[model samples]
Target: MSQRERGTRRVVRSVAAATATLAAAGGTLLACAFAAPGAGDGRPVAGPGPCVPGRCPAAYPDPHGGAVVGRDNGVNVFVGGDFAVRGAAAGAEGRVVVEGEFDLAKGSGSPPAYHVGAVGVGSRVPPDNGSPFLRVGGDLKLAAGQRLLAEDGPVNGTVAFAGRQTGTGTVSPKAVRDTGALAAFDGLREELTAASTCYAYDKGVPRKPTGTAVNQGKVTVFTGDGTSAFQVFNAPFDLVAPDGSAQSLSFRKIPANATVLVNVTDENGEARTINTSAVALAGVRRERLLWNIPDAKVVRIAGGGQLQGSVLVGRRSSTTRLSVAAVNGRVFTAGSLAHESGTGGAGGQTIHAYPFVGVLPECGTGPTPDGGHTDTGEPVPFPTGVLPPGFPGLEGLEGLEGLMGRPGAAGPDDAAPAEGRELPREGPPMRASMAVGATLMAVGAALALAVLFRTRSGPGSGPGRRT
Candidate 1:
């Protein structure tokens, strides 16, 4: 062929090859734009099963964290360890057993009248001073020490001392019985522990609330009367009071029937601290509110506050301590009970009799209301602009589309592709597109360079002057 024709053909072939490469790249990009999946339809995805408002099971089998005290006939204060009523006029409607020494002395009498109903001293019981009067309805058992002074002080009941005693303290009829009156507390604590574990596990982990979150950790605070039947799952943080007072957490106007359960998991046990002193239940019964702090070492209730709920602490461990100004509900602790006297007197804290009923009605029976279920394993809906798996290659396409608006080649028909067909709703991935584009461009450039080199190196094409 003529050299001119040959050169023209070479140019045409180069143009054709470049055009084909461009076409291929365009097709690949078009496939990505029209074939990628679109963003979720913004509808709530079905999770597990139908979630009727009140269809789920209660978070706890026994609400009130397992009934520690009965409604009518129950003790005012039941200590697992040693008991002391110093300068505090405290009485138990039921029997009071002091695992260690029982000191019925007047410490700082704010009420000025130090008295007890039924006192069972496990260890030495010293002679009662003539000032503060100590009363006992049932028989008092003393391991050692002088007989109780019932002479001047009215002893409605008898006094049984294990050893000899001599003092002004009233000594009632001596009777020797079993020293294992407090043994039942062991089984009660165990039941509480098991119930707490089940509650925590069922609730799962706590997620940040969509509303305002305070402090650095994950916490959900409800102001005024909380929404009906609220449940906190796997909540491992501090629940401060609404007023933001000295760690005084308050729940005001909680509905009479509403129940609130805070299940703190073992993983976040160290951060569990609840102060319900300023809480106003608005006539809500104490049994309605429950706090499952299985691993908590200390639970403090500030002064001048009344908490309406049941507190379940460690069962076997002796590190649990419950410090409260005054409690209207039941407190089951495996360790010690410290009462911060607002009255400034010792042993003057009055523990009113309120038995725990059962789990709150709102906890539901199936799973937590946070869209998590123990029965069917299904997660909550995904957030907007994010895509789940099952779509091939379009991985990270959503981000790319967000970064670089929409693809220029996308048409009206490409808005929603055929159902069941995967499409890149967003643009092609930036990195992948750049890499592929660059590779194709480079190949096209190399092909044009080869054509130029071949034409120049051919006969009579190079540096002119052939003889």
Candidate 2:
């Protein structure tokens, strides 16, 4: 064909190839997050293991509608005065319901076992096609054919708790922990280590926790009384800060509203004083959050079906689980990686959803109007603040500075990195490849244009022609 046509073909081919390569790369990355094994299954195990009832010490006060359950390890579960086990009774085929200020204390008792805040009458089924039986609440009914999550070998069986459930205050397998109490204890230990280290260093002392003065251990709790009470005990060991400074921790009565600020030197400090909520939340090991679960009561109305509820996946909220305390805020179910979770807390309302957690979906009514008054330094209508219809209002002023542009101007060169800006140490090969690709594309374009000009000149081309 003509030279002009040949150059055009070459340019088209290169562009097509590049487009295809980019598409393939994007597809692979997307699959990794969405299609990976156990990624889309979105299932959870069963409730926690049986709690070993602990004997209250002489220092323990009389039970005023409260109970204290301790673990062999440094863990304790305190059932508050207001805390009540709803739904089922012991040795019955029903769901065990927990609500209202259940305290999970770690490293308070002996033997160092993790304490379960609240446990129902149930155990995880082994890999045998045995009787599909589980202990739960009195109100639970499994329709014609329903089953709990159980192990049937390597793969999961029909009782997969990963999907949805049915019933009033229905407890699905999604909220269950597969590994049982042993796994819970391991998780508790890991949590203490991670939380303690984060708290110690964040307080700005040295870096790590000093094992001598303060062993960064925690308590596993089973039951708790919401009332303010104290327990006295001598640590077989001493507690130390990061700087190797020795200090003894007082096993005093923890206040109802006042949370334990582990790293703070000032006892008078409030929650606002701490920059990271992670630090503030650390004090209350057994705390509840509010999550406005929509269509949750519908599950009960339909005798337990796969009802839709919004989940919030944030830093602090996502890590927590729904407990008795959270029931006051809203009907809480087991949360997944895709949604938020929380437990019951103080001022527990049976209708309100308490203790928000994770990344929650927006579903609010009414369109937030953008009144175009932004010129007067008025707040711009943030798209994030507007929730979807039927969603609870989760709008709070966050990331406003970044959105305002005072911190980062629109210009590329003007926008400097906040702190560390690491550049590639060596990039000869990458630079060369990019340079070659750019040069080739530019040259191809120029040649194509030249060919077009020459062809248009019609056999008598004089200028804009290459020999």
Candidate 3:
């Protein structure tokens, strides 16, 4: 062959080899990018165990029980059975909802002084005699009774009677249905139960109660490391103080940022009753403390002692009962709640409803057990928008920022993009991988073009030379 033709053939061969090499290198880079777990390939990444607050969404699986409490703070007293208040001074900071009959006995010598923020009764309700005054936020439902006696002559809120009203209260003919309020009670119960499960699964340590007999005077303390701190007791125990008064339970050796969960159960596969009449809890915040007693039949907080944190009692099949005097936090029971009068201050019981912050199970972020790629073999196009701020696996790619646009900024678009066209709200797992793959492909394309340009311009095709 002529020199020119030979040179052309050699150039062509060189370009072909370069192209092949570029293709292989690109494929290798892509394989490595996706092979690394959580490189942003779309697969769900296992979350860090015991989810951190603010990092998790405030929805179902990790619904920040505290936030739920904050939203439903309007509800104070929620009873699933017949509710009767006789000669007792009970008041709630929020609304009260009773599923069954509600009877409030009049105080002797003077009008009955029972204060409720708002009252929602499902069945029949008796009229108040205006001791402290009835200032309900919503309508009050009564079966048969005289007009509510308010010191100011009439009750502040609306009143609806079932049969007929004989006294001097403004009665509405139609009974307003407060189904949402009742449903909130049910939802709160479910959420608390779910929270109990999450807390137990994430931070609890399974432990059986020690000492054959229950000690009334001695207190039990459970502590834990920074990450997981909990005490799971399979046996039932009572809460009484050392002085034969109230039991004291304390937590120690816990990290400042850690949570404490206490699980209690009885030998008969039921939740043992925990009496907190004279009990005290030290070095524990209501938000960080969780008591999950799914089999509990009764949770009593009587006497004058203070009890803090969230309590989850009873399961789906059984009804959990609650008897309270003074409590510092929220309580969730499946059955009924009885607030003893004259337990707190000056003949009234106080039960504060605070938020409960429970831990959630760490989501699995690793590869699926089947060990297969999530992609359908069809290439996933690289996502638009710059790498998220502080995105992982992207530190080394900072040098290529000029080509990828500013970090976290969408690509140049004069017109506004359509709504919901933005990146995944929950943050895509495989985003970084897609970016790496795209980068590798871009590099390969550039190399291929350069090889072609060099092959066409070098050592071949001058003025003539002969074929």
Candidate 4:
């Protein structure tokens, strides 16, 4: 090979290498530009925020923003009205705040000692603050030995009641009869009602859950789709297994760390009487599940199945029978609660202290959509003043603007941390990553063109051969 031929080969190789570099950088740039904010750098895309129940999507009034349901706010059992004991009610494992009267009288059977240990010792970090695990706004009655969250064994918490106390029971050491613990929950009922409606009728595409929910003769199986972040299911018409010793609900096809929302409604968007056995949802975790009852005028959980998610009821005045059952997550209702939890203890039937950490649609105060059950009407305006836990107020908007050009600041496209986890302290934003990629590609292209032009114009390949 002559000198000129060898030089031509070298130029070809240099151009080929530069072109390869540009292609590699282009692929990375696309990911930075299009992927959900922070996805390129391995941060959580969207989930619950730092505050309980989490912040709403920054773009509030967007009609196309899908559903916007509030969270459980870390309270185990939240009732807007009276909480009366009609049976042997085992107190909740987590925090309990009743807006009205609290009665621990039993309708039948021997009185079982009720226990209320907020954020119980099992698998949860108990609170160090002496916050009340039980707060009653109205009259309190433990006629049949209904109890407060007494400091049992290693569990220590407080209780607060606003009204007169009746009956006899073991109360907590740090009990306050008159206080303002329930003030924060003043309008929470109305806010949750709107959210329940929105979640029930969220109109995002990809209809039909990506999982398989088959209703067998006695059991129902739920398999999740690993691709999506959420595993939504419309539970079977019949929730109870006719045979007592059968697993009524079975979970399968578990998604890769997904948030499951089970909407148990009738064909006309109504609530169903949930009768379950005293068995845990084996595959699903308590923190990641939600049971949404959008139009529940009355929620009755009879027989025995242990409900594994946070339940949200839309109607405030709805009467509820939460007797003789166990719930592993939070329970929110806006009506009178008729409760008798058969047994009370870590091993017995009880309401565990797992807060709901699932991601539902987050919008401003809005009305139910106008159409079928799935109809999504125009979302109402963003809240005006004194926003709820998740909704940011006018002054709070400052938190929205991340550190101008700094990485890790909460940007408009940036998602909140999961389950109150802290946001990353340092990192590059999506735009920064894209900029780096684009620069790399541009440099590679320029280098390639300059080398090719120099080689061709040098000796034998231009309009006029040089030497």
Question: What residue runs in model 3 are displaced by over 4 Å at the alpha carbon?
Answer: 1-89, 95-111, 118-218, 226-235, 241-245, 269-271, 277-282, 316-324, 342-346, 360-467
Which residue segments of model 4 deviate by more than 4 Å? 1-73, 107-109, 118-125, 144-149, 167-170, 203-208, 242-247, 267-271, 278-283, 303-305, 341-348, 367-467
The whole-model lDDT of each prediction reads 0.34, 0.21, 0.35, 0.49
Q: Give the TM-score of candidate 3.
A: 0.44
Judge candidate 2 at residue 379 and give its lDDT.
21
For model 1, the superposed segments whose C-alpha errors exceed 4 Å read 1-71, 75-77, 84-177, 183-186, 203-235, 238-248, 252-256, 264-277, 318-323, 340-347, 360-467
Error of 1 at 402 (Å): 55
The most accurate candidate by TM-score is 4
Better of 2 and 3 by lDDT: 3
Number of the top lDDT candidate: 4
Worst 10-residue lDDT window, candidate 2: 268-277
* Candidate 1 positional error at 115, Å: 5.0
- Candidate 4: tens digits of C-alpha lDDT, residues 1-467: 64444443443444345335434443333333333433312221111111132232222121111222221223556777898764455556545778898877654454546666532223233233355667788877776454555455555767788888777755766667876656544444544554554455443211256676666656667777756777887763546555433346777766655777776654333445666554345566656777766554557665555666667765554677775356656677755677765334222345655555566554332222111111121111111221233432323111101111111111121123335543333346445444444544444344334444444444322111123
* Every model's TM-score: 0.42, 0.17, 0.44, 0.58
For candidate 2, the per-residue lDDT at 419 reads 52
Task: Quote model 4's TM-score.
Answer: 0.58
